[model samples]
Target: MLKGIPKIISPELMKVLLEMGHGDEIVLADGNFPAASCASRLIRCDGHGIIELLDAILKFFPLDTYSENPVSLMQVVEGDPATPTIWKDYRSAIKKYDQDFTSFEMVERFAFYERSKKAFAIVATGESALYANILLKKGVVVE
Candidate 1:
């Protein structure tokens, strides 16, 4: 095991993060997401919550500075009453790494799935929250 790496990150996930280049995107998929069908590369993080995974990933993953919205969240259907309070938790976690990070771009449900199909990789987590799926764009690491 690596000394500084978070125990939550599996070896395969760490390798995927290392292989990703600037502009590539990765998805943190909720339990409800169709991860298997949508992912180009899939990493199973079963029994893990998105909030904790988000926090752990941000420790080493850089957000795309070139994109207007480096972070994107799946939007709830128009008539759906689910408020997705977990989004605030996600925002808080992101702010810890990037103080300037504000809001996430809301992508339509179908669009989100389409985007997921093209993502560099998708992490299927055990989070039960509705609309918890998030896509993070990669950025170049600065020296």
Candidate 2:
């Protein structure tokens, strides 16, 4: 294992993340996601839930500062002002690393899927919760 690397990040996932350029998006999705057909590269994080996998990834990657919403989630069909439970957890996890970031946006389910289809890669987690999916835009490592 490499120093500072999360063990949950497999070699394949590591390679994909390293190869991705700034602004490239990656999907951390639940088991119900159609990852096999949508993913350009798929990493199987079986038995791990969304938050766990997201926490691991945030250790290495920073959210893109250039974008208005560097993180995006699939919105619940009936829109409401209250944040979705999954989004709440995601916010907390992300803030653990960078507290200044508080922006999050939601897209229609199908629109989110279309966006995921173009992602650099998709990490399929074993989370059973409905709408437990998030897309992260990779930021540049500014010197």
Candidate 3:
């Protein structure tokens, strides 16, 4: 055990966070996401929800201050009739760490998968909510 590290963060997840540099992005894929096919590097976080992982990751991960939007989400398809209430929860959790955080870049479903494929790594979570996928860009940690 390490002091200050969240118990929810696994060794593989921690190592991926350490390996990432500024500008690299990580995807926190929802349960329905095709993470195995999309990820260049995949970190299995089975049985954990994205919200808990998001809060825990935000403790050590810095959002790109240089980018206007350091976060991205999968956009709901047209006429889907599914209202994603989880987005509100995402905003709340992100704001807890980044006060200046405004909104997420909404990527069309297929575009999101394409973008995720190019990410430095993807953490596949067991979040059951629809459209719960989120992507976070890494930033420099200033002293």
The parts of candidate 3 lying over 4 Å away from their true place are none
As a TM-score, model 3 comes out at 0.98
Give the per-residue lDDT digits (tens) of candidate 1, residues 1-143.
87989999999999999999999999999999999998879999999999999999999999998999999999999999999999999989999999988779999999999999999999999999999999999998996
Deviating ranges (above 4 Å) for candidate 2 = 79-83
Write candidate 2's Cα lDDT for 14-100 as tens digits. Answer: 888888899999999988889888887888889988897889888878889899888998887775554447777889999997787
TM-score of each: 0.99, 0.91, 0.98
lDDT of 3: 0.95
Write down the lDDT of every candidate, Cα atoms only. 0.95, 0.86, 0.95
Candidate 1 has an lDDT of 0.95
Ranking according to lDDT, highest score first = 1, 3, 2
Q: Clash pairs of candidate 2?
A: none
| Best-fitting candidate, scored by TM-score | 1
Task: Give the per-residue Cα lDDT of candidate 2 at 84.
Answer: 49
Error of 1 at 6 (Å): 0.7
